[model samples]
Target: MVDHVYDPPERCVAGSVGPPGQRTFFVQATDGARRTTVSLEKEQVRLLGTSLVQLIDEVAPREGSEEAAAAYLDNAPLDAPFDDDFRVQRLSIAWQPERERVVIEAYDRPDIEDLMGLDPEGDYPWDGLPPQSLAIVLDAPRARAFASRCTASLEGGRPGCPFCGQPLDPSGHICPRANGYRR
Candidate 1:
């Protein structure tokens, strides 16, 4: 499988398409004129952003990190021509102490049907081949900015149910905490 590596991409951000409750999330990485976008679940984006922040704090905690994140924040929307190259199935993140860079890898599984028969170990049975992946490496500031932007994008979604914390749809949701009553 091809690994599209963007070491220090010109721009990398997590964004969503469509309205709040019905949004589709994606991670886009751009290097010069080349761009790659991968579709993923909302929870995946949230977890990645949260994990990145935690990892940075653990590896390079400093007061200036927040200031630098704000200074380099990318509030702009995802780059246009928003086409998804693949659907991400798994994600991995790491902090490289030697380079002081954060690396994020997103593995793609084109379709759910492709994994209809998986082994007990959750390994695919496809000729021992690995999934296509997209990797992005970012400096401390850029990494923080990416996490901040991810948080902002997530908050832009539909408000959560006050009782259950689940997303409240336009017609309201039957919050379990509210005893199945629509709220």
Candidate 2:
């Protein structure tokens, strides 16, 4: 008997938005094996300044190995092109070997407001916001450190997502995935 390793399709290509007030978009990569969706804010999309396909090729986790994938995500720094105006406020990476899926989330922080906006009571309006969060699914090692830090920052002292400046509930949000889906 032989055990075979399977690689899931790369979902959510990376790219950036064009100028301020521009809408940025990326495609979810599908290879008939898996389907994923990468969501980012208009500012983050602008910060990427590259094609989603190119970004996925550059950041997708390794097949059958979570450790390698986590390392890839941890070391995969935000592109320098938009580093001046954008920073990775929060990041969540999850790898499901059994399902051959990896979910990488990066909340873009364009500034202090973006950071504070994560708080539901931070004095910002979030009625029409498109969930300024990004999630990438693939097969790889779980990036626990990033997720832990993101959660701690959001729920530790202040209450918010820390990355996108959105309000958060220590008890969790209606989305259930609040606190990075920590239970």
Candidate 3:
């Protein structure tokens, strides 16, 4: 008999929430499919950034799907609210199956404006450096399942000693305690 193991779900490819007061937004996942919609308070729209129209033009998907979600991220035209002198230096993607969420972490650098061609040697007038981190959550079950399968494959392939329940390497272990007890 073939034993079917429980697999988690996939991670979300993309998602977003409006600023304050707006209802929460979500990109729900279904059978490897994704759906996007505006489901949040009106006040939340302000948090999207200063150029709402540009942001929507770049990120808001006319059609909902994983591909569309990825496109949104690739073309996201995020603008700095405080100043026009900033750029994303690094970006990281993480999926949490237990929480049913996908997180995008971004780290901004001081010379971002110069790198993005906005300005050369432009002084960022903000009180302090822009935050180094940002997170966006999306719903993706298939991603979670994939992650689970990968993790299982790695754990199942580990070599261990049957008698002692200890992991074994090609180089055998010398157990002094076992030898002393035997003596």
Identify the candidate with maximal TM-score. Answer: 1
Q: In each prediction, how many residue pairs overlap at the backbone (N, C-alpha, C within less than 3 A)?
A: 0, 25, 18
Candidate no. 1 TM-score: 0.85
State the RMSD for candidate 3: 20.6
lDDT of residue 128 for candidate 2: 48
- Model with the higher lDDT, candidate 1 or 2: 1
- What TM-score does structure 2 among the candidates reach? 0.27
- Global lDDT of each candidate: 0.84, 0.38, 0.34
lDDT of 1 by residue, 11-119 (tens): 9999899998788998999999899999989999899989999998988777328887787788889998778887888788998889888989888653556566756
lDDT of 3 by residue, 107-172 (tens): 444344546975656676543643533344444423332222222223322255555645454555
Cα shift from native, residue 4, model 1 (Å): 0.7
Candidate 2 per-residue C-alpha lDDT over 43-158 given as tens digits, one digit per residue, 9 for 90 to 100: 44433322322333345523323354445333232232332222345444443446655555555434455466476566444344433544445433333222222222222233
| Model 1 lDDT at residue 70 | 81
Instruction: Note the residue pairs that clash in candidate 1.
Output: none
Model 3 has an lDDT value of: 0.34
